[model samples]
Target: MTYKYILPIDTKNVSLEMIGGKGKSLARMASSRMSVPSGFYLTTSAYKDFVQKNNLQKDILNLAKPEIIGRTVSFESASKHIQELINGVELSDEIVNEIKQAYGALNGQNPAVAVRSSANAEDLPDLSFAGQQDTYLNVRGEEALITAIRDCWASLWTPRAISYRHQMGIKQEVVAMAVVVQIMVPSDVSGILFTANPVTGERSEIIVNSSFGLGEAVVGGQVTPDSYVVDRKTFTVKESIIGPKAQKIISSDKQGTILQDVSEHERSQSSLSDKSLKELTSIALNIEQTFEGVPQDIEWAISHGKLWMLQSRPITNLPPQPIEVSWEPTPPAKILARRQIVENIPDPVCPLFEELYLTKGLETPAKGQSRKSFFVGGGPMFVTV
Candidate 1:
């Protein structure tokens, strides 16, 4: 089948050329048993079409060039012109029809969808370009969806995004954006999950940060959330910390999102029980296994007591773990001293050094010193061999 911009669920084997990283990953996840929300992808081809039809290739090329020193007038006018050009373009009929059809297929008429950006370079292993683009929440009907798609495309050129791209050595003109239209889940609770403990990099442990209502308050650092640490192997709840929640963001009946104060009774309560925590941790482990690497950041939501994974990306800021080294037998007193020394060394020292240091006092020389024939510098000398 000859597909244009958007693709349905049946297009499983499409490469990054058909969709972008985010879209392809979502499709792969959906095709599997993972509980991803229903959606379709507005392919990068459509974005390319918009740029080409609007004669933006040369304009983008010009904007991407590094400015000369002391060139004040050049930078300002060029940036302004690019922004104006982007704002002036309108969505074409072909793109609009595909989006409407996809929305209808997922949610029928008058449905609310979450329009999110899935750029070509996001969710990568070496570097994650997260939050560089925009996401529209609780958008209803065709008109709002279309506007949101345009907004997402425009967000690819936000000042912060432009700066990040420049810093990452990614040319703005070479990057393209694909839109992910997902069914909006009206979550009672939402938060982030790390398959490994971010602070410690413990692979056997999983950490969850949750709060009442949508995940925005927690993600935005607007409120402190209740945290739960689970042992991946035993499925045991290791620890839980309940934080004071002042506010929550939720979907509004009017439209978009709204923030409201959480009630006193709900503020200190745990979002998930022991069983639920274990189940969620298992799901996270499954995703990690499926993705074949440890995930750094995971966004999830709980609706009607069932957990759903919204998104996941590698945690780029975490440092590597210290390797373990085995030690031979050592005397008890010496082992105690080694423990004391380890306590003093606050930094993460090499494990091999730690093992050697711990066993240093165990080695003992021969009891009696006897005169033995030994070679010293290729000549015979009287010494212990």
Candidate 2:
């Protein structure tokens, strides 16, 4: 019998279809000499095999049928059922033994890891499933790693994920998941770097968001991180905004991950230094170049005062950026209309706000234009028509 493959992070033989987008990207980065944390990829074949052995496809697909409520499709029941089924299933002996051996080779006993879900359907040009699935951090030991991997597989059936796939008209039976298990970085600071300015659509600038401890604090909205904008050309720190960080997420031997209150003195400090910011920018720029200058969203962690690239994906659905540094306003004959929101709205509108605020209440049917996430940002709160 042909068995599934357990590939290392530096493997160059696998494609995105095999390991899923996140794993493929990380593997590519590692192969290209990028400083990624040592880890391995559990290919989608594992997930497929588990589903096949447990005979879960029919049950999962049945649970994915969308029900029309008062005005829209809802799959709350389907999502819960599918997730329970996924989590309850057991893996085959072949895959389980391979995973155990790989885990042992990672770093002996109880190596801390971050198990992240990498769905085959994610990171598409039109869709950005950035954080729809689960990520278990600071996972130590073989049992914890296995549990985390199972959780990631189950996250493929999460409520938000189900709804997203449903709206996108993707069949549940076709969706498969891979898990990326990386050696955990005990980071002094961890955060994300956008090669292009995600907010202002400035391709010439890069944005960095950093906070204390694990990046979950920054990514989970648990803390407002210090934001830094860097000039792409000169690699200069163009702007910096300090955020009030009230707490931090750190790892403890006793508890895998524990939240500790930030001290009064540390709350006001910037998480990243100018030097580290420059280093991060250079790395991000390199990644963007590797992807043919299409902007990238990268995750990084700083440990032992050195920066490591965790993952990199294309920046999806950015507005057209300015071609020239200096340009003129609209010509007199035609009235100009900017298709963007001019306010300090956050990047990637929250799901609740998108469904409730942006979609339900604020739409103006009279204008004959549905609100399509109007180029969101802040500037005078004025519509230039």
Q: Please give, for residues 1-385, the per-residue lDDT of candidate 1 as tens digits.
A: 3447777743577776566667767776667677887777898889889999988888876775445558532344445566677778897888888887777777667777888888887777776667767888999988998989888877777666666667788867778889888888888888998888888777777889989888877887888999988888898888889988878999999569998999999987887777777777888888787777766578888888877778777777765664676543322212212233334544444546535552232233357753222212211111222
How far residue 69's Cα lies from its native spot in candidate 2, in Å, is 3.8
Clashing pairs in 1: 296-315
Pick out the ten consecutive residues of candidate 2 with the lowest summed lDDT: 375-384
TM-score of each: 0.81, 0.82
lDDT of 2: 0.82
The best candidate in terms of TM-score: 2
Q: What is the C-alpha RMSD of each candidate to the true structure, in Å?
A: 7.7, 12.2
Please identify model 2 stretches exceeding 4 Å from their true place.
1-3, 323-385
Give the Cα-based TM-score of candidate 1 against the true structure.
0.81
Cα error, residue 68 of model 1, in Å, equals: 8.7
